[model samples]
Target: MEMVERYIYAVTQRLPQGQRIDIAEELRGLIEDMLEERNDGRPVENTDIERVLIELGSPAELAEEYRGTSRFLVGPDLFPAYLSVMKMVLIITVSAMGIIFAVETILTPMSILHHFVDLLISLFVTATQVFAWITAGFAAAQYFGVAPPGLSGGYNRKNWNPSELPPVPDKKKQIKRGDVLTGIIFSILLLVLVRFSNHLFGVLLFEDHHLEATIPFLNEEKLLELMPLIYLMVAIGIVKEISKLMAGRWTKNLAIANLVINGAIFLLAMFILRDQAILNPDFVQQLSDSWGISKQQEEYTTIKTVWKLSYNLALAAFVITLLIDTVTGFYKAFRK
Candidate 1:
């Protein structure tokens, strides 16, 4: 009878979620009827259950019959997660690239058409890459015998309890896969930009139908020196975001991980910010020149003071937001 429950679980889990309860009940009745007919109302043992299961056939074959088809590249267990991840990645990547394209178009109206074409090409390339990598990862995971818990062999319907199921996330409080994917993309972009900050964050001067990168905000030497810490923080963030995406909801363990990663990031940021010479002197000088304010002038002094204040404020805001997020994660995971 225990094996019968497991057999039902194995089959019904592969069926549509909406049909699972009904099919499970029906299967139980049918199995009992068969056992009753066989044992003539005697107490059914494990041998009887095994024989009934063997007659009913393997769970996979039975599931296929219920599903009405055998066509699949990825098994039912992994397909939902695969589709969700692909959709999330495409949405985030396309939206981010579209925003950048829009900004470029606005900055240079004469090349709007050219930029639009470039945007299309960029979108296609990015989408293709994301799709390929996500699919490959899931495929590899599946091939290696890693799978979602209920989809494989371990789940037993008899052991299933309502309390063990995760709370149905309130629409307002839910952590969406798209959000996690967006975070991953943002972190990846940060890693890329920081690793090549001299090229990506430079002051752009447009002249004679061309754009020239004049100087960058961060000192090259200081930026390179900070790369080790920065890379570690960003790598941690990427892994955390990926874990959240796979989990598809907040849990106590994930909340703890989030808190730890956020704390590490904040500490690394503070260490980097403590260095006064992190910003390039030439960048400040160029800014002062552009604003027609001499280094000795009160206006230049005021500008520098404002810049420092803004930087500190931004850092404070970043830390506050991270803390708020970590707390919110815990609340979501632990709330009644």
Candidate 2:
């Protein structure tokens, strides 16, 4: 029957590839036998097949039973915890990646169409990687019989302690996952951009619907020199974001971690910005030429000076913003 075939397909699809054909055949035979018994030796029809399948239950459940393992990628005992953690990781990862992408698009001048295409590809790849890794981590934990932290003895009443319960989190003081995710994404993208600026940071010019020129803005040597510190900062940022996501609200520990990360970032930013040779000379020359500054000697010097000043000012503004955020977090975390 068509229903029989469809039902068999559903069950077999959940099974291992090698087992599908044999399992499907066996399941079909059982269904036919059951239908014959139900129909009193009459021919089985699609409705009979449907009735048989309904009595047997869902395909996934039947497949699992046939496999002789009650366990899933995540067992029932750990499912609640798994779900929570999975949601947090997914939200953080997606949010962070999105923020980084937006920042990259804004900071780096590029063709809108090209940037959108690049972003779509990057997001798809990154999202898939993040989801697979997070799911695998949880699945491995489930398989290993590892319990989620703070869920002692699997939600037993014996472990309850009213006195040990944390104070009610202030709703206004909640640490938003979206915000934390954005920060994490920003840090990660910054790390990647800084680490691979030579390849990624370039200006493309088009003329008559054809690419005319390309110019890179960063010196590879200088960027490479800052990789270690940049990596450290990025790692710290990721850790902080994860902590914030887990806590779900501002707390002293998270606030302190945020402060430390911000401080470290500020120091690194200062160090990186102080390098006079960090900017690619050729890029500057090209930019100057494009601005038509080379033709006016007096204007060239003044404009160059203004550009350098603006660069320092931008860095300063970033540091100041970090300081403000750190202070606000500290105050909110510690104050009544």
Report the Cα RMSD per candidate.
12.6, 7.8
Candidate 1 ranges beyond 4 A from true positions: 1-71, 99-119, 139-145, 150-164, 170-173, 188-215, 224-231
Model 2: lDDT of residue 275: 56
Model 2, span 1-336: residue lDDT tens? 887788788888877799988988898889878988999978777777778889999988898888887757876666776677667666666665565666556545466567778778877887788778867887887778665554322343457667666567687788886787677767767766665566456665667655455565677787677678768777877787777766777888878888887788777767766756677766656766866768468877775677678667877788788889998888878777
| Candidate 2 TM-score over all chains jointly | 0.62
TM-score of each: 0.62, 0.62
- Report how far residue 213 has shifted in candidate 2, in Å: 4.2
Clashes per candidate, residues 3 or more apart or on different chains: 0, 1
What's the lDDT for residue 184 in model 2?
70
